[model samples]
Target chain A: MNILAQLPVIPIILPLVTAPLAMLMPSEKMGGRAPFVFATFVVWAVFAACAGLLHSVATTGPISYHLGDWAPPIGIEYRIDLANALVLTLVSGIAALVFPFSYESIRSEIDRRQISYFYAALLICMTGLLGVTITGDAFNVFVFLEISSLSTYALVAMGADKDRRALTASFNYLVMGTIGATFFVIGLGLLYQATGTLNMADLKIQLAGDKNRMVEAGFAFIVVGMGLKAAMFPMHLWMPNAYAYAPSAVSAFIAATSTKVAVYVIIRFIYTVIGADFSFAPAAFAWLIAPLAIAGMFFASGVAIFQDDVKRMLAYSSVGQIGYMLFGVSFGTEPGLAASLVHLFNHGLMKGALFMAAACVMLRVGSHNCSAYAGLARRMPFTAGAFIVSGLSLIGVPLTVGFISKWQLLAAAFDSGRAWAGFLIVASSFLAVIYVGRVIELMVLKPAPADAPEIKEAPLSMLVPMLILVAANVYFGLHTELTVDLSERAAHALMGAGR
Target chain B: MDILNFFAERYNYWIFITLMMMGLYIVISRGNLIKKLIGLNVFQTSVFIYYISIGKIAGGTAPIYVAGDMESRAHGGGHGAENGGGHSAPGADGADALPGKDALGAGALHADDMPHGDFELAGNDLATLTGNAQGAHAPALHAAPDAGAPIAGAPDSSGANDILAAPALKIEEHAIAAADAVKEVAHQAGDVVYSNPLPHVLILTAIVVGIATTAVGLALVVRIREAYGTIEEDELESADNVAEFGAARAQEAVA
Candidate 1:
């Protein structure tokens, strides 16, 4: 047996094992950095495993890893194709990069005794996301989604030492996220009742006929449930507070991966499992997602410009960016789905960098308020520089990752003959400019308070990850072939129009 | 009768929806943190009920095994005598009643009755035939209508066989054939053939997920109570707003 055939499961199993081990390892005697260092190594190992899995998938077609040697319908299967492999890589890759940065941020934000627990939760969260991406079973999706969400709630609550509001923020997220997960379970249950199978492939084959009410209801429930998790449009009430109040590392990690993973689940269900030819396809994209995405793009960006806290501002801006990704999906064309996939990957890079920058600032400034950014450019030039690069990327400035995604998305709209969508895509970037501009103005132009303490540059540990992420934003922007090609393959896989 | 059939076929689904709605209503309407989590559990359990309900077969029992013929052969002379006695039960008698009859006898109830509503065979026929518990009625069973009059209200033939096999094992062990018992088990297995096992497996995973969510949710609530001095959702919001305004004032001062 080729040992490498089992590579797809390693990413999930690594973290699953590491998380409990991290919890068992004492944090006090080894210093707060022990769990951090171990987790960083474990996450990087998961990233390497994902990279190996992706490499094998690219070469040998899809790899199906059956748990306990049972076949697909009888046992849990981990199927890795180009689409989910790319997502797996993104989640593990981002977790690996963010964990190193989390050390100092968690130290500053979380309680001394709870730091090891925080690392454990973060590792479990990563494992959950990886599992969600890799599993071939429909119910496993719900299971992994909850696993990640539950850990994420705890991770967010770890910020209670920094701000008491983190408590309420985590609670709200728990309520909303649990509801979403339950809705997802109900949807999966309905599908299981209708089709009598839990394997995603088996579900697809069983649901091939004209829309049955149970299947349609299952579809609607799943979309709405995943939308809530993705923070899609009006369902995004839980996101701002959760992102804004969480420990900066938690914010950086979750803001980058959690909702993106949710969006991936939506795409997987809509395009792959249910098939794009389902009767509800047009109405779902047109009447539901299309208009909502447009509304979100405008509504969230408008709300974002008025936010006082820079982290909350970015959180709202993240919601609007999600609108852009959904708008790409709404077109229901190959280019549209490709654009959505591209933006999904590109946006992760940009958001990770931006949130890391915010964390770097929070490290020195002791606050997330935009007012605290006064003369930050002069105070911490490197971090301020990283923030500007990522902020500009968020605004879709030329030669940045955000611009590449926006360009592809607009091109998709144009090719699909939706001139209004193209126009709106461009117009929304103007709103991005306004919100991002406000942060830049505060950092660069506002006078420093005379009573403000001398704030040193963020520790090298934090800066290295932020700078690497910022570099990725610029590097991936200039060299678009890697992300673009992978996304096209993923989109084609979704469309079922190509091998 | 039509309404009863509809309710019989669909009552599980109705209960599922009702429980689902009650759970969702509880989650949405409750303000207390613990209540909301309880509501979530109820909502999730309703789904579990829905999944488990889908796997039910009208006359089927739990997905398990009953002894087959090969195993009966291993039982030697007792197995052969049991086989001889069992197949001689009413409606099951034929020249080759020992082996093939058991296979055909269980299905003989409904399969032979092609007419939709006209067929009428009393439930007591099966009771007396399989059990021979009413030793007094053994003559009546032998004198009863031949294969002409079908067994009415047998509902499911496999279910009838299940009822046939259990008591016959003790009271009239030799009356029913060993192969018939296997046939009874096989018939029961056939009704179960269409019942899905995938949902049950998935629900096992889902239950674990539910417990995990409950644990983490309660942990978060405990932390929230520690920080805000309240587990009430409404009270927590006011505390959050107070902090929000404080930050806003701080911003205004800098500006």
Candidate 2:
């Protein structure tokens, strides 16, 4: 009974346990069907646990479980406060919904040999993400980060069977990702040596009077390292190719979770690890992160406008979305943190649905290019409807999750005494509308190719997940109390930690 | 002299600074990805050295384990040696004395006995002995009293000593106390100092991510190679553009 008190470990452990079990399943006939079902169940269980854990944390303060019963400052601990628990729920919930959709999607897109391995990699990636969100120990975060990253690479590589360019895209990602992870580790190592303790809470207590120059150097390394991972503007070179060329399932999953997790880590570092009072405050943040974020928002959107491939365009749009998140965090205020968290959740839903819709299109039309989607609304009405709704959310239309996030971020920027930041946010939304509108126009108004093959609606399995996310976009848009309140609490905790 | 003082005063800082610059240079200048990672490592390691150096106490040993094993044995050995020496010292002092010396003569012959009245006068002549004995006990008593009196008088006599020693003792004690306090603070602060572990962790993850990304990239490159028959980036771009051009031309033909 006492051992069972550690239920929080289940979210990460379930997926890890299932990943190997997936590989061990016998015969392709059984292996193919069984792993996907098993993975779906495991992901659901994780989502359920994460939701319960999030509720528990919100009601009863943070939950901290030390692995091996070894107290903190020695052994690793999994700490789920309001902020991360909420993120954990968001990520795991998305996975739960996405996995069922993946079954039908994977059947058509991926080969037989890769299906079991695909589920295994997906599970491993889930474990990494869950581990990242739950662990209180700083180094544990890194370890889990690698676990997720390695699996993500394998998943991205799976796309090569479809498009040969997936190989080049994966390779480019590998190069950039290695640099980012290396930078992250160096920063963590420096912090460890400086403080002699890897426990975050203990480190916080110890760092109060530490005004050394080395600490400042560590701060710089961490920000840059995480910035690269989160795909903040100039460091986002690897994102477009990786997202565009990967398999539809891989693209949807990575698009929804990978950069969001990176953003979580960055927020954890900036607000919790290095208290906001540190000398590298407003000036450094404004000077470094803000310009790049603004640049990314405008430039990526502009670039996205020219992409012939729908998936690639969305990939570039993702870069621009990341820019908004960075912009929110750059404000360095409670409202700003709240805005970032909101956008983090909102963007996940929007991108997940958008990518899933693209997968549906690919399933029917055999390509994700804009030309292929011409008159798609007539042939595949539901998939096209899903696309339009998700696209509207991406453009921050009212009564959608995207609008909630953008509204909060604009309000945050205004609250931070930068009223013009609101204008910039709106302008970026306008840019998004332009890119997204172009695709909508091509899908609804343009004539289908005279020689085009007859297109059928995507299978129910794929549409279920896409619709769920689109529904969530609308549901959360109108009733944002749960998401917004959770974000607010997270913001408070972050602000308190920063001080 | 300037160079000597500079080295003597800030040698640790100099070492860290040099290493930091070297690491930074490697990270920035190198073209190969792995080499850049190694450079990142060197830069981070230098920061580690800096933090560790600052936390060191001037005379303290590294926090290693040794005292637990030796403590009991050393205590037992010290007790045995002290007891043996206390008993044997009396005999050794007497054996090394001149021949014919009695216990009283031996007692008087010791180096520490001069402060008390002399006992050798009793052995010389009866008349001198009687005269010396009359005041000898008195002098012995008075000698003990004088020694006792100085104990009380010592405080007054060393008033000037107290004045001289007071500030120095205070200074030394304060310095030691401050060092100890700083050490405690540093020990606690040790956990929180931003060591930039992120960079180290990020580097490894980035390497794996890089490799994975590279594999994916190469796989894409291979696909591009198959589609266009070249691994070159420029060629792939041209081919993709050509494909787009073909698609546009096909649209034109239909129109």
Candidate 3:
């Protein structure tokens, strides 16, 4: 047995082990920062493992690791094709970058006694996401999804130290997330009954030419369930408060990775398992995903512009950004799917940077409200600069990662002869410009209060991660080989698997 | 057939659907967090029942195997060579046999054949045969020849007789003998056909996942109540609204 072939499961195992270890760390008067140190090291190891797995997959094609040497169709398999490899890299890489930043981000927000538990929950959440991306079994997806979601609820509730509203936000999210997971399992049950198999590859083979009502019902359930998790359109009611009220580190990590993983699952279910030939009818695409995608773009952006809280504004903007991804998927073409994949990676970078910047500002100002941001540039120049760059990226300004994805998205929109969608995409970016510009205007243009206290920039631990992610947005924006190549391969693999 | 008859045959499905609707309704319509969690349990349990029903094969026993070819196993030393020579390709020979047939004990059964009603008869016959073999070795085993002796009456009987009687009538021993006989037949027939253990295993996993979700959910609810002092959805929503309005006014004052 080549041990290198087993590298796919290490990303999951590293964090799974790290979480409980972090929990076991004594937080009061004993282990000052041991939990943070342990968690950061493990997250970095997960990132390395994911990077190695992605490289192996890109070179050797898909890697199949039978857990305990059990073969597929009988045993659980962890299959990593290009699509999941890209997501695994994105999720673990973001977790690695965010954990270092979280030490400083949580120091003020969470109590000293609860800090270790917070780190424990964060690592478990990371493990859940990695597990979801790596597992090839349908039921395994549900299991991992709950693993991540349950921990995320706990992590969100930790924000109660800073704001009690975080409690309700976490509760609402728990309820909705549970419902979404149950629906997904119900769909998995239907498919298992119909196909006598739970493995995605086996389902693909068994479900070929079998388009009964039960299969169609399963398709509906899976899409709706994943859509709720992805926060697609009307199902996104729980997101704004949860993101706004959660601790800034949890916000940055979850905003950057969780929904992206859900979208990846939706794409996998539709293109890989259901087969785009059956599920991707023009009428269905136009009638279902098209309206929801467009509605989420405009409605969310519209709601965002009116928000006073900076974090909540960004949360609504996150919903609008998800719209662009779903819009790309609605085209049901290679370019469209590729554009969605590109945005999935690119938006993760941009939003991670933005939320980290927000965390830095919150460190100084004690609030994430727009009014608290007046003349912030004079006090925290480095963080203000990071936010400006990422904010511009959110607006799709040229030479930023957002521009790259939006350009691809628009090109695909027009390539598919959806001129109206192209126009709408451009229009939504302008809405992004307004919301982003509002922040820049408040931070740079407004004058400070007369009795304003002198506040230094965020600590170096936080600054380093924020700058690194901001640098990635600019670097990948200019040299798009790695992201574009990976996304294109993943998109082609997905489309080729369909039908 | 009328609709009632159709539903009667699939009463489990009808019950699943009804329980699913009730659970979904409770989850959506209830305001209390704990009630909603109970609703979630009801919903998830319905799915479990649905999956278990999918794995339920009519007239099928538990997925565990019972001996199907006692004659071949009893005379296995000769039968293996005879069948291996006769069916050069074992898979094809197994596929050719009739499913659910009682030709198993005569050494004519194949691996693909679904064990049916005759499987129990075959097990009893093997149990008796094994019993007789033991009786031959130890004539003292014939102390209590009552095959179905009441266990309550055993205490009044001779101690040795009670031991012999209980062992002969033990269900587990019968099952073990049957399984042994089935394994021997499986070796002769080239494979074992089972009642789709995969779904049962997968659903067992799903049920565990469901319980984990419920535990986490209830934990969150407990925490939410501790912090907010209320776990009712309406109360929580109103509190959130009040907080939102206060923040808005504060922002306006700063402006």
Candidate 4:
């Protein structure tokens, strides 16, 4: 029971504590492997904790632990409500699965000298993500947000050995990320000025009077700041390059966690901190947020259609996926919040599977371009199978996790008296099919190039992680009670608070 | 002609109409994203100013606590009695009794007084005890101007019972009348518009948003420079065009 109570902080702090320990390892050859193994075990522990936290939150309601026993409104609190607990589980589980594969993958892609530092940075990045999800304090969220972001920049920049452009991508991400963090800070400052509180629960009580201008300003700042981080539409320019240019392992880790964490933060602010009633009824924030979501879906997907690189296309797909999550939120209802939460989990699985498969292909073919993947089904059937299954989920095929989210989102839009929004949600699924279909066709149907060398299945280390995520995509798709029920409860909490 | 004259007589409408138009124009015409942000700031600020202006009493400050003050008295004056009582009692008679009284005192009195005492006392006895009930139930009886003269001029009379009733009734009527007069004066003294916090909130949010956006824009510019060796948007476009041309030429050469 005591260990369970301490689980939320452990998920974030373990990686941070291990980062320096990873650096203290004897040498890159023998001792370097120690960090990779240790990180893998730590990530597994975090995954277990996330699962326990999720179960606890779903059954027993929100789990809030004050840091150092200082209660909220004064002390920083770590809150594992249903919404964030579910995301925490997804993120930690993916990192756990991905790190084992990173051992072999890193050996091939990154230099031997960089391996120890890479593991150190990877652990720190994990800490940032889990911390961002678990903390209840608004400013604490920013601190974790920057920690994760700075590590991500370092991880992305480490790709300079393979492609010099990775430096530029990392630099761009750094700038955009800094701006996003600054915006977040300014928003928090405004909220603090208006309400004189940093704890989300306390801020809610302080902001109920509708007489504070500073608080309202704070809400806008927080939303836009988070939107930029989540790659919301026009704000998403940094993502594709960053995702495409980074090393395959780095790309997979980030694709699975970073933006999804950002989306979680946005949802946390909209539903838990700001309350849905303000977003939906009186202010009509849905009217503002929905259009941007819809625009991102079509605009990013359309731009993705022309990309030659499969990774870049999936990167654009991430922007569109973020749009779906945003669309669910814009409904500002229980079903809407549920859809967003479920999609947050589903998209992570689909993207993790897809990017890992891309990494596998990159490992074999040494390129992520569509031309390089020609007739990969004939050569590497397992990787191709993983891609197809995850791709179907991405396209929201019936009986998949994506379908469940889209269906709920459509229902939410209709419930909100905006049936057109439902139509748009359905229409955007077709755009997904178009982009996902392009990659599948090239990988499965097209004949292999004559000059191309013979390719084999991705090694057990890589294939196992891809298969696990793909399997999760299907498992969650069929038995969605856990994900959907928790999301519904979270949405209820949000809507009830607003009213 | 009459409608136009009525509108012309109300100068507040004219100012509202003019400020609203100017606010709309600034939001529309700005070029720089930051300037547009500022325009948005002004546009939202004007709306806040308007809402505050509309809600203003003749004397009111921003609804913020002043330093060195134990309590905030910003939202005082008009509608004071109703607000002072913390919106519990719905009847106008209760509101009238506490007209123009400081909210803290009246709030405590109403919270303690009405719910316990009013239900305990019945019909005519309740009406006679609380002057508000007598004034409200029989406005015409209380309105008799001669009632005041008897209270001031006569010590003994055939209508001594009526005379005793007169002073209580007159005082209740005067308080109600005073409340109405303050309300009328507040309506006329609409120049001191109550500060609407909504626009200030919106503007502050916009400024933060603007700074964030500028940072993002500058970041994108730096990224473009690094990627294409130029910060200019047009140069980046040309660089992309050239990259596309090179790729197409390579494909043609392979064919």
TM-scores, each model vs. reference: 0.83, 0.74, 0.83, 0.69
Q: Which pairs clash in model 1?
A: B83-B177, B83-B178, B85-B174, B85-B175, B85-B176, B86-B175, B86-B176, B86-B177, B87-B177, B121-B152
lDDT-sorted candidate list, best first:
3, 1, 2, 4
Q: Roughly what TM-score does model 1 have, to 2 decimal places? A: 0.83
| Better candidate by DockQ, 1 or 4 | 1
Off by over 4 Å in 4: A279-284, B1-255
The reply for model 3, stretches above 4 Å from the true place, is: A279-281, B67-195, B244-255
DockQ of each: 0.24, 0.10, 0.21, 0.02
Of 3 and 4, the candidate ahead on TM-score is 3
Assign candidate 2 its CAPRI class: incorrect
Give residue A485's lDDT in candidate 1 (0 to 100).
Answer: 85
Residues A1-499 of candidate 4: C-alpha lDDT, one tens digit per residue: 5776686688877888988887666447683688788778888887887888888888888888878765565557998887788889888988988899787777777777878788888888899899999998887887778778877877887676776566557755765665566567657756654554567886776666445455667777787888888889889988998999888888998998889999888877776677665533335455667788889988998888889989999999999889988888776677777788888888998899999999998898888888888899998999999999999999889877878888878888888898898888888888888888988898888999988887778899898888988889899899988888888887777667666
Best by lDDT: 3
Docking class of 4: incorrect
What local lDDT does model 1 show for residue A297?
96
Q: What's the fnat for candidate 4, on a 0 to 1 scale? A: 0.00
Q: Give interface RMSD, every candidate, in order.
A: 11.5, 17.3, 9.9, 15.4
lDDT of 2 by residue, A1-499 (tens): 6635878888987789879998776427864888888889889988988888988898999888978665565557888898898789889988988899888777777677788889999999989988988898887786788788778877877776777666656655765665576567657666765665567776676677667766777778777877777888888888888888788978998899889999898888877787878776676678987898899999999999999889989988998999999899899899988999999998999899999999998888989888888998898999999999989999999999999999999999989899898999998889899999998998899888899988789988888888999999999999999999989989999898877
- Candidate 1 lDDT, tens digit per residue, A200-242? 8766776776467878888889999999999999999999999
